[model samples]
Target: MIFTRKRQPLNKLTIAHAAYTLQKEVKWLGITLNPTLSPNLHLRMVKTKTNNTIKQLTQIIQPTFGLCQREARILIVGVMMTKILHGSIIWYTNKNRNTVRKKLTGRLFQAVQLSTGMMKQPPLPCLELYGGIRDITKQNIRLAHNYLHTKLAALIDDGHRTLIWKDLTVPQPIHPSPLNNLIEKNTLLQQHFTRTETLSPFPVPPWCHRGSWKENKSGLALRNLELTWRAPKG
Candidate 1:
């Protein structure tokens, strides 16, 4: 697909004796892209797919039988939300816009309502709180920031890092690019840090032998206890 801001006629081309035509939109890597790069169509498609999945889930997540509330919540959040927010880092922006926010939150809340067996009378925030789900906008922003953090941390060349930092930090009027918005939203970007440089508790060399499970039972028990304590209480 040709990406351009102006409306124009499609151009026909022949390459390797094969005819090709310009497409208004195309799917690449499971993301739908148009010439204008607007995310509306892609998001619509995601919403449709999520709706279908929710319908299927409703069959098994009955109020009287099938998956329990906890399992339903897990499925909705872990599977349904993960699918809905797939590729969000690329197309998600203007998250606070009323139209976009309402549409996405409405669809997500439907899934939450299904999982929690809640009535529509409840407010979105209450549904989210009871369902143990984060706001879709917040989740998208966090994902974008985490992606930026990972990319920045993985850069090996100082010059390349500087170039990227400059690009991300560039000022844009009115509507800012997603990366720039992420940089602005996250204070973590103010400092540069590398994952490789971070200190680890287990600093022993790879060649060093570790103790057997029998010898590490106390540590294992402590770790398990910590995890159990940290887990959400139903």
Candidate 2:
């Protein structure tokens, strides 16, 4: 409750900034946001026999644009990387936050050629990870950002290349013009599909949604108030 309320405003602004950054970086890339959400689903299963938690999810095999199913696996990783990068960069710099506010309010919302949608199902993998969000509107931005930053960073790094929108909506790119390439060379861009633990400094500019972790819980639940007395031994 406390964290959500405190983060409400920041989250919105952060998304706004990211939208702007994406525009500047991807303007010539010819990727359109899917307005109709194909809706990705992620499920978590606990193996009773093994007494271990296993995560089950679909691949984020989005090809430039289109629709696909995927797991919420990327969210935790992006947030983790963001939490670390935001702290180091934002704090280290002595700049104004006014730009970040401007980008979120002005650019992200103001855009063209985008396909957008949210998950139709509930009890999502993210619910357990996020302690359960009530609606997609509140959390989808972060989810998408996590997906884009970690997953789509390739598009940003590849620079001046045209990618086939192999996903769903548009065939071939709307813009074949060369892109300026907003990123520097890094190994993660090559390995996003295979490696999971790869980390990099988030590329959000001076003004963007950047935050520190209030708390990041590592293990699963501890006490079950009602079942405290009869709980199985660890």
Residue 91 error for model 2, in Å? 1.3
Model 2 lDDT vs. the true structure? 0.23
lDDT of each residue in 1-234, candidate 1, tens digit only: 222334447566343234545466533323344556445665676667655655655554443222333443355443324332442422455453454334443444344334333333333443365555557644553444344333333431121111100111333234222222222222343323311111111111111122211111211111000000011112
Best by lDDT: 1
Residue pairs clashing in model 1 are none
Best by TM-score: 1
Identify the runs in model 2 with alpha carbons over 4 angstroms from their true place: 1-70, 100-234
**What local lDDT score does residue 193 receive in model 2, on the 0 to 100 scale?**
34
Model 1 whole-model lDDT (C-alpha atoms): 0.34
lDDT of 2 by residue, 1-234 (tens): 111112122222232124323321121112222223221210011012111111111122222222221211132222222222222222334354454233222211111001112222221454467655456533543443343334223432322111111123224323211111111123444324321111122232222222211111121111100000011122
